[model samples]
Target: MKNNWADAMRKNVHHLAGSLGNLLVESFHYLALFAIGGITAWAAVMAFLGMMEKGNITVDDILLLFIYLELGAMVGIYFKTNHMPVRFLIYVAITALTRLLISDVSHHGPADLGVVYLSGAILLLAFAILVVRYASSRFPSAKVPDPDATVKGALTEEKGET
Candidate 1:
């Protein structure tokens, strides 16, 4: 009985600590999001104005599009899910690699070219795994309850119902 009581107390303390920590962390996240959103909005407006004034569309303009889009996506996802996932790291990595490749491919040698190509391949594989994992997790074996319908058939039935 004493050990059980101790364990219960420990659990309660652990839960309390976790709750407080999460509250502190989320508060910081909200502040950071507000600051970043303000700065990004200001910068995006300035960049659009600059592009229009120049009359020449540089790759920098396109880069700005991607940066703002990804930033917005990251912020939106956090608000929706209340937390970020490891899968987003793959997306960010791929985007960063693509940006680097686009900005510097002309200045690279054969070895550098191979490295960039390999980086792209690895990113592709990571994205494929992420897709498969997300798909399987979201839509598990639908035929588990009724074996007569194959998984694919069950998925088709699900789609039809939806």
Candidate 2:
């Protein structure tokens, strides 16, 4: 009986520790999300102010805004679905590279320009690979169920419907 009591106490403590760890992880996740959101907002505001001061939005400025918008969309999607889409990151990278090329063309030599273009091409290839991977999947992983659908399913079950 003493051994059993000790074992029970140990199990309970282990379970409590696991729960606390999960809670801590979730708390940090939310904190990081909030930080991303705040930084994105700051970037957007700064970009807008810069454009306003210049009285004209150049292509580079517009590309920077596109990057900010992509980052915001990535955060919003992750917040809603808990999934980070790689395509958005790729899109942001492509935009940033294009912006760099456009802004630095006057300063870069022929070799530097070639390197930038090569880098952009490589990123485009990666994006193509991702698209192919997604398209060629015969059986995609199950998506997270919608909360409303879950509730409806439960209600239908309680009403004895199949």
Global Cα lDDT for candidate 2: 0.82
Q: TM-score of every model?
A: 0.52, 0.72
lDDT of 1 at 43: 78
Model 2 ranges with Cα > 4 A deviation = 105-123, 126-136, 142-162
Kindly report which residue pairs in candidate 1 clash with one another. Answer: none
Regions more than 4 Å wrong, model 1? 1-26, 106-162
Error of 1 at 61 (Å): 2.6
lDDT of 2 at 150: 77
Which lDDT tens digits does candidate 2 get at residues 1-162?
Answer: 999999989988986887789789889999999999999999899989989998987888988999999999999999988988767877787777777777676456555657667576757767775785777496676778765577579879989997
Candidate of highest TM-score: 2
User: Using lDDT as the measure, which candidate wins?
Assistant: 2
